[model samples]
Target: MSDHDPRPDASALPWSCEAEQSVLGALLVDNAAYDRAADLLRRQDFFDTRHGDIWDAISRLVLAMKPADVVTVFDALPEAKREEIGGLAYLGQLAACVPSAANLRRYAEIVRERAMQRALMQTADEALEVARGEGSFEEKSDRIGSLFATVRETGQRSKPLFVGDLMAQRVDHYNALAQGTVTPGISTGIPGLDEALGGGMWPGKVIVLAARPGVGKTSLAQQILLHGAEAGHTGLLLSQEMERTELVDRAVANLGSIGYSRLLNGKLSNPEWQRLGPAVDRLAALPFAIDDQAALTLHDIRTKAFAIKGLRLLAIDYVQLCAAPKGAPRNHTRNDVLTEISRGIKALAKDLGLTVLLLSQLNRDVEKRSSPEPTLADLRESGAIEQDADVIAFLWRVREYESHRLIACSLPKNRQAKPGAKLGLDFEGHYQRWRDSAEKVGHTGSVGGSADLGFN
Candidate 1:
């Protein structure tokens, strides 16, 4: 028996065997045609199991900088596997099946589309089972809807994921972590914050950071973005509130420890000017992009994000400023509109496998209360913010802001680790920077200096 068995409705489901054959044929005929595939089609996308096997062999050879032709593929295949696929003559037939390799990409797309169709049909089958099972209409509806949501969130499960296999993978992950072979997530660059986040803001999680206006939310959020970028992770910042120049200024000030006002006013002294070179060079090396277009809808965000290859982190200035994909109804309240935006953002985070640092505004009620600090309730116009977010953090400060420059980061809700975790970062507004509370900033001979931030 073959390793991969065809499904029950294999014939009934949508698939173009010709497309699958053509992709393999192109690769076999012209070894250089593998670039046309460009990591687009996976082995699982192929309809025929033998074609998938051929694809795997071709991929391995091409990736090794070797040619993937008839003789090599035949030798790469095991004896039993080759017999199952009708021997060397079959590979020869596929090599000669295509006239040219010019249309390989289109053929790969068709194979992928058919695979997706089959996946959607499989998801529908699961939904049908939930429909027939005993449950209320609403419960069944939610269950059915989630079946499709899974398809969007992480393509298709492909097969039943047994816990035994999953547990083994977890063990490997844990072992790797302990052995320093892998990292849990991208670091926040703050040791205490990383500990609170169970390493860091993991992929596929929505982290909501809310604060009242003039409380340095944008500064703190952008500080984190700079840290992620400096750590060699590809990140995008969607700033609807601040201009791109102001954002770059903040980054420069934060990185160089130069006075923000002096930099902005073009009054940077000799020493400050000297430090600007390293800061600018550092910024230039980072793989970060900023889109400061006003009024970006969720669709616009998603579409623009696709243009950025290997994007892992996306930070929006404030959730309230973002528009929904289809726009809200006229009858919808402010909360309803915000709710739609929140849910869509959360879905986008999961769909794109991103760690979205979603900034929000704390409602006025937080100030009206005896305490000026915020809770989950202060998550601006939407209760959905709390519902959709994996981590809800606040910028809390009770004492004076300018003098002490202490900002408390309080996490009231954290799904990955202990909640009610608090960490303090000292804000140097003069420099538009945030540093560990233990660190200090002071002026040396003529230049400003700060504790080593360990950023390149």
Candidate 2:
């Protein structure tokens, strides 16, 4: 056998040299074509390095309000680089390659598709290297996950919409609203919250539920998830702080109306036992999934969350526990990592067009105040969390009173409604459930008289 391996065929690599030439030619022929092709193509999308450079130069000239053509581009390039890129003649050749600028958009699409394929090839090569390296299993796995995320992101690239196109979409939305055919947003199962939010959680929004420990942030999130599931929306709850079993226990207690302590201690009475079976069955029937991966990185979460088909909402139970991806700068402070996590979650929500509810711990500063209610400023570690969140609500219950059954929920920041809105919820610690306080009157007179027990 020959010592040398056969070279891969050039044609086998995903690329459209002709399309790249066409796009460049169209831009050179008519600088105005830049506007049409700007959104669809980027300089890096060109397979040919020289073509990418020429495109970059052309873009610079056009964006600067100067004319762009073969001569102008050639003149714009550095003298030392011209000969390396086949001198000025290559520029003239590219301009002559296209018949007209009419199909510039089509050419751009072809270039983008080829670029995406090339990106996948590159990612695959890097992943194979990782697999063959001496890295640990987790390292290799994380590397692969990061590569996959990059591929997914590359596939999602698209041109920005023009003003006319955006206005058209806006008109359609208004018409839908006028016809009473569109549900404004997802409901949180709290009537007061729904009214305050003008519907409920909306797609492409980040809602932060911040509170001190023992104030029921997770409880409130579970309530919202249960409500969403009941409304036929699928949700993924990523719990870094709690085990999946614990989550299920809470859900069971909340749904079964069984005492949380009884479930935890396995001291259930016969009546509670009777309710537990059906409650477990009901919880199993909901379209809610939980991942209790400890110390999950942002990339890990994104990979798993994106895989869930029809995922409408994502809940991160206490974001501070999540780890930044491997290879993050060692010099990054804790606050920097938290900020990155916060922005990453926010971006994920927008990119996926889903709602993200992030539970967060309040700072001790809130406890030092005479009024211990949490505020947006009380978001622990990073101010970016407050800036990135579209809605920030604080969960506050009286700390001094053990018998107070009401939890105070105050919205310090509401993008869709007036801020400083307050709502009271009846907290049933036994069941790990929160209900509108108004619902308490009817339950208080029940034969069991269990609802009268103040558990906060």
Candidate 3:
């Protein structure tokens, strides 16, 4: 192709030199435009090397609370690099080229679009390489998914809202609350827990449900998922430790009020069998799904979660069982991996605007103590779980038969309500369910302490 040809050569990559120039010029002409452009455009978004350098210099000056005019930006550039960007004269020309700063956002967007196109081209090349390599199908799929996730994240870049714009949304929310039309969050189906949470589990929150082994952490998580589904919310249960059939069996036991041992051993009476039919039917009708993928990485969970339409809540059976991303830092200890996993789950909750309830195992320290009640410090593997969680609840049950059925659900950390709130729950081991204890039941009372078998 000729040098002046309108058609691009096959080897030529996507770029927008003019758009990059206009963006930098706009910032220089009206320094206020830097705030708007900075959100949409990064230095690397510029196609030309010189333009990239100029944008980088402008960014440093603007971020330092200094003016980013042509003179200031030029002066900020290193002496060795000034000559490489066509000297100070080119900087002046760039500022003069833009007619007005009114279209700064548009120019920045164009630059960003070109950058994304270039990134996609690079990603395609990498995918081709992966396809040609000798890797497992799952490995290739994960690599491709990671690439797409990166691009999706890049496209979600947005400017910060003005206080006035935020105030408008706040006013609307206030009106909804006043009119009693607002559904603040998804309910856990337990009135006491719901009340303690101010309403229920909110979107974009990470809730850690932890306890010593055999304390019903998984059961509680399943209960929340089932209840959320019954409340007209779609939910996903990612069981890294349990089989799909096992989870279904637990659901059946909870729904039918049958003994779990009897259900497992096929020792149910005819009446119990009859109860199971309707319970299974009810579960099938609800919008709940389960995945029993072993050693699942965070990316796998995120990909599977995104495929479920209208998913409002996601429950991971246990956090420690989850595998870290492939090729994670070799120097990272087990605790570091767990910390990364916690942060990843937290980020996923915020990104998808859904609630993530993570079941976790408590450290042995809780059991060694006289009380045997778990705390935020007792979360296994990493303390990062406590920091990342919006709410941290510990399920404490005395192992004796008499007290085994009583679970003291304590909230050690609650971002939405007062912390250290404790709820007395009657644990029906046979039914695999929990009910709020009666008002007369003390926090440390046994399951039989309450005459009420239903939640408030």
Candidate 4:
């Protein structure tokens, strides 16, 4: 092939040179190394075999395009083969492999990278121009938004499927849904709660536990962490209110069967101390990690979640505390903030493919009058929580603020479960636990004392 002409197979390039050039040029202009280029190239199928080999040769040649380096590379090749192919055709190998569908992917990827870099550079330039008072805020935002839109829109649509044809596929993907196999493996932290939640939280489900504050929302969340850890699940508990030590104390008191006051006051009998020591050790050993940052943004949480391995269930202590992404500036009203919070939580649930249980505080309006019952409209701040949440649960204990009275845990709004079906639970102050009252009443109260949340 002539110096100006691309080889015959150039059209078959699996990857886009424009993309590679865009990314490489962008990175190079920023003085970034070519290691990522190697990575980008390796993701292609043909690159795994032939194109990868030829691409490396092309990269080496391009980097050392200087005449002296070219001479050295040529000299290294065998004399007879060198004479037969010559330097030009040796360089033409890249062009020859370019048209192959396999190589096309690498070329396209490289071109995309180059385009991105160019666009980014242009963006920086435009930003500089904006800083120089060349454009208004509206103009800059629109321009930046449009440029990103173009680049995002231009990205490769799909790669060839590795799984072959759909008709010939044999793997039973729906076995989990059909045979009821639980793959993600999450425990709801309460044995009874797990049973109620269809054998604990399934992957990629959003479980919104909405309740008025001081009604055992946080305690229930802690219970989930305990149950999950007990079941050998690695739990990441992101709490907004409590500090790490406070969480540890609560976990020990709630799940470890240690008295909260005793643990805090450092009071225990010798035998009790022996039991608590190993219990504390076991609690420490459980695959649990907690972040108690007071006001973390959703982006920050998403970043941290990405770092966690074997992550099963994600429990956000409360959703409202989370800040929105860098953009979408929070509006003046808490309603606006709630809108952002709901969107963030839902996005996180879908993105991470894990069950998310978000603790939500209810409006005090539900408590002002007699017969306190929560409505879906009572969800604080925004309706996005109700709209996006898969399941919404409210916590109501009869004796929390009242004397011995029967309180109903009602689900006025259930996305999946039957609406108006109340899950009856009894509250005990001494043990601080919520127990199922339905089975007990049917059994004629023969089960001794009723079950409680065992909260302190």
Please tell me which predicted candidate would have the highest TM-score against the true structure: 2
* Root-mean-square deviation of Cα positions for candidate 1 versus the true structure, in angstroms: 14.4
Name the candidate, 1 or 4, with the larger lDDT value: 1
What C-alpha lDDT values do all the predictions have?
Answer: 0.78, 0.81, 0.81, 0.57
- Model 3 CA deviation exceeding 4 Å by range: 1-12, 16-18, 21-31, 53-99, 134-165, 256-278, 329-331, 398-404, 439-456
Each candidate structure's TM-score, on Cα atoms with residue i matched to residue i, is 0.65, 0.82, 0.81, 0.62
Query: For model 2, what is the alpha-carbon lDDT of residue 44?
Result: 80
Residue-level lDDT of model 4, residues 1-456, one tens digit each, is: 223222354443443444433332332222223444544443232222223333444456546652212344355445654544345454344334333233333544555464455556666676676556655664555455545445544443444545567535444644554676643236554444455555557777777787766566776676677777777767788999878997787776655556556677788666557767777888888888899886666555665676788776778888878764334544546677667667766766766677777888888887764555577877887888888887777766454333222334555555544555565565433223445554321111112134443332
Better of 2 and 4 by TM-score: 2
Q: Give the better candidate number (3 or 4) by lDDT.
A: 3
lDDT digits (tens) for residues 25-54 of candidate 2: 899998988988887678788767777888
Question: How would you encode candidate 3's per-residue C-alpha lDDT over 260-363 as one tens digit per residue?
Answer: 87898999988898898899999999999999999888788889889999889999988989886766678978888888788888988988899999988887
Q: How high is the lDDT of residue 384 in model 1?
A: 89
> What is the TM-score (0 to 1) of candidate 1?
0.65
Give the clashing residue pairs of candidate 2, or none.
260-430
User: After best superposition, candidate 4 residue 23: deviation in angstroms?
Assistant: 16
Return the TM-score for candidate 2, rounded to 2 decimals: 0.82
**Distance from true location, Cα of 435 in model 3, Å:** 2.2
